[model samples]
Target: MGKKDKKKEKDVGKEIVKDKKKKSKVVKSEDGIPIITAASAIILIGIAIYGYTVYQDLAQVPEMPELDLNVWWGQNTTEPQDTSIRPYRIVFSDAMESEIRWLFEMYRRPNKKKSFEDTAWNYGVHSEAFAQFFSYWIFKYSFIQRPKFLNKFDHFKTNIQGLDIHYIHVKPNVDANTKVLPLLLLHGWPGSVREFYEAIPLLTTKREGYDFVFEVIVPSLPGFVFSEAPARRGLSPHQMAIIMRNLMHRIGHKQYYVQGGDFGHAVGSNIATIFPNDVLGFHTNLPVNFSKLAYLTWVFGSVWPTFVAGEHVDKLYPFADKVKFLLEEFGYMHLQSTKPDTVGIALQDSPAGLAAYVLDKFMIFTDPANKNDPEGGVQKYFTYDKLLDNIMLHWISGSIATSMRLYKECIADAEVEQVFSQIPTPVPTWGLRFKHELAHSPDFVLKWKYPNLVGTTNVDFGGHFAAFERPEEFSSDVFKAVKAFLSFKK
Candidate 1:
């Protein structure tokens, strides 16, 4: 009786264990749905959050404060708005002159062991060229006479956006009945209003083919020279464009034309984009595209040369080589864009350092190949006096640091990409491509970014400093652009 009872108990236990194992297998196969569903839900939520953040970032446009011009000019409430154009002259103090002279005299030359090739400007500013320029600065160049030469143009300072905006206003001495159009000529880095000195007379004088003459107004970009440095940060090119438009308004120019190269191109683009109604037309020598589409456009354009490069396919092709060149040339940009204060302090302290820093850009931008030359090819395009005069403007103003800060302030702005690519300039646009422009984009590439581009001219002689180097060609191209704009309007 005990044996039968033990066997029955064992069989019942085995049946119970087998049933539990079957249920466990079912759970492993079918019960994992909720876990998988939960994981998928978490992944979906993460993606949604990331996409929203990117959209918000891309959609935001930076807001700029509007400045009251009348209040800023220091006019009392009772006094009538002093819109009167007062003549302004550039006068340097004795202390400033002495300081500059001392700095030049005390310049530290490269070590005796340093060869010209070792100090090639392609790597940075060549020591040899800096020595020659320094010699001219100390012995031959006259800062006093330079201002007198600049004074040949009518210079004026007007308060705009709480900053003293200095500009050269040249009117054609034509009959009162002759149609005169206001032209705002903007300059970029390593250049100043001095670049336009030679082109002013050509622009103001009426050409035979063109009926209209340009009343050229070339302003020192804020913080460049006479124009006051921005009191606060975040004064991007967009803000400068606002100040420029206001200046034009204050001068009774409801509508005007604009042209620029380098930083000026960015500022003019902002003007044309933000104030399309006021900017009748726009032109630039250096046209860049910052859109997302540019990547694809560049890729396809590289293979099919004519699509973007046109006849300049040879120059624009071999895109990798261009990238390599850019990487080499972008050291200053990297430094300035990130830690401008570091280099700024060095440049501000030493005139020779400043000359090397500033002149390096002029040399490379004029022609990157010039770096191989011991003189950086400076003598071919720019005279010692002219180059020194340009440097003097930066030296006298002590604006090297402040001007460099623009790169730091504007580079990280979320709006820069949007403004550059998405925002199109609706006004008639023209492009003048010089042979030695630092970054040469073919006319077709330019047209893609500037949809309303009326025409493009590929000039053989000029470079980035086209106005300063080839004033006659620059003036003629400007005349052609203005004529095109007028014709387009008609």
Candidate 2:
């Protein structure tokens, strides 16, 4: 038991302590295996459920409303109806002029009209803009010649669904050997057949390299302009689609292409969705997909936007910012969708108030930046006479109230939309995405809804009113779309 024996004893104790610690670490590692395996199994099961949900949604084909071609919208018809296609004319009758004169006179009165200091359209139509518009309407708007210009395009009316359906039907002035295709052009709120007036000639006439031209038919939606209003309560968007289809059938067209914007987009989309075989192609300026997959893909895009959107990523991403802007912009939609009759009474009564209400929307929609323009830059895209032509049409016909009701009809039944949301049509589609458009869905996202999406044209200008704002570009896109649609595999 000397110094060497003592040193060896200390070394042996240290080894024994280290071995116990190693055994304890091995036991702890073994205990965690089941927890790790259970966690992985849970994650795998969740992933499988998510995949199935997405697949089930993708495979869904929505059940559309069963509508009747014989369903009449007119009220209490006691006699045999005249279904003849008759020529129609727009007249600025003395009686209508007399009614308009007094309304403009009241708008001329100097009153306590004011807006907050330095605030622009953020508060609504700028005060100065409100005055400037009416001044032009009273002094410059030609109620006389504007009607002639609007009538230059041949208009006709025929009884359909017991209502006198008014439409502008134009034939292509091309060679007889060239093909003539039927095109159903549509309009939305605050817009009429007049919106397509500038684009109609372009579409109907010849284009380079294309052998076919569109025999364009633009309709003043039922309850708007010269078209007869529905007598009953059920003229929803789906019903509007039915009316439009019947109009085409009455015009001797079995199938046709469709191009629309705003609520026109809704009706046109419905037509394609319900009768895929009847519509040759669907073209829209405000293209959006309501399918559940579109929503899921959009949320997925937020995390990795490059995967969902490419150059237009900014338009789709920072989702919260877009949500905020939509909530801000949709106040009008909420009002019109819920109680259009309330405000419709005012718009139907006052030409000036109606101009202000619609022009404010035009200003912001043409370019969101115009919301900051104290003078309101609507004149940049349209003429004073042309602007009043649209405003006066609503006023003269007293269709403001009826036209506004369309918004309510469109959103009234959530079930109709819930069913529509699942439909993915085989109809070929095209999207004209403008730079300042309120929202944009890239090609990948659009494919889920429009599987036959042939193309998307990203214009470097304009906003909501494409045909009115940039007719040349809009018409060009329509031509391109029709060409692709014809050649595309069904």
- Model 2, range 1-490, lDDT digits (tens) per residue? 9999999999999999999988755553355655556677899999999988867656666566676867788978689988899999888898888888887787676674698768888888888777787777777777788888989989999998889989999998878889999999989889888888889889988978999998999999999988989987778877888899989998999899999898788889888988898999999999887666677778888998888888888778788887877787779989988898899998888878898888877778888788787877868888877677888788778888889888787777656765775777899999999988877777877877788999888877888988988889999999998899989998
Off by over 4 Å in 2: 1-59
Best by lDDT: 2
What local lDDT score does residue 205 receive in model 1, on the 0 to 100 scale?
A: 94
Against the unseen true structure, what C-alpha lDDT does each candidate score?
0.78, 0.84
List TM-score per model, in order.
0.82, 0.86
Q: Could you give candidate 1's per-residue lDDT for residues 205-273 as a string of tens digits?
A: 987877789899999888887887876667777778878888999888999999998889888988887
Q: In model 2, how many backbone clashes occur?
A: 0
Q: Which ten residues in a row have the lowest lDDT in candidate 1?
A: 67-76
- How many clashing residue pairs are found in candidate 1? 0
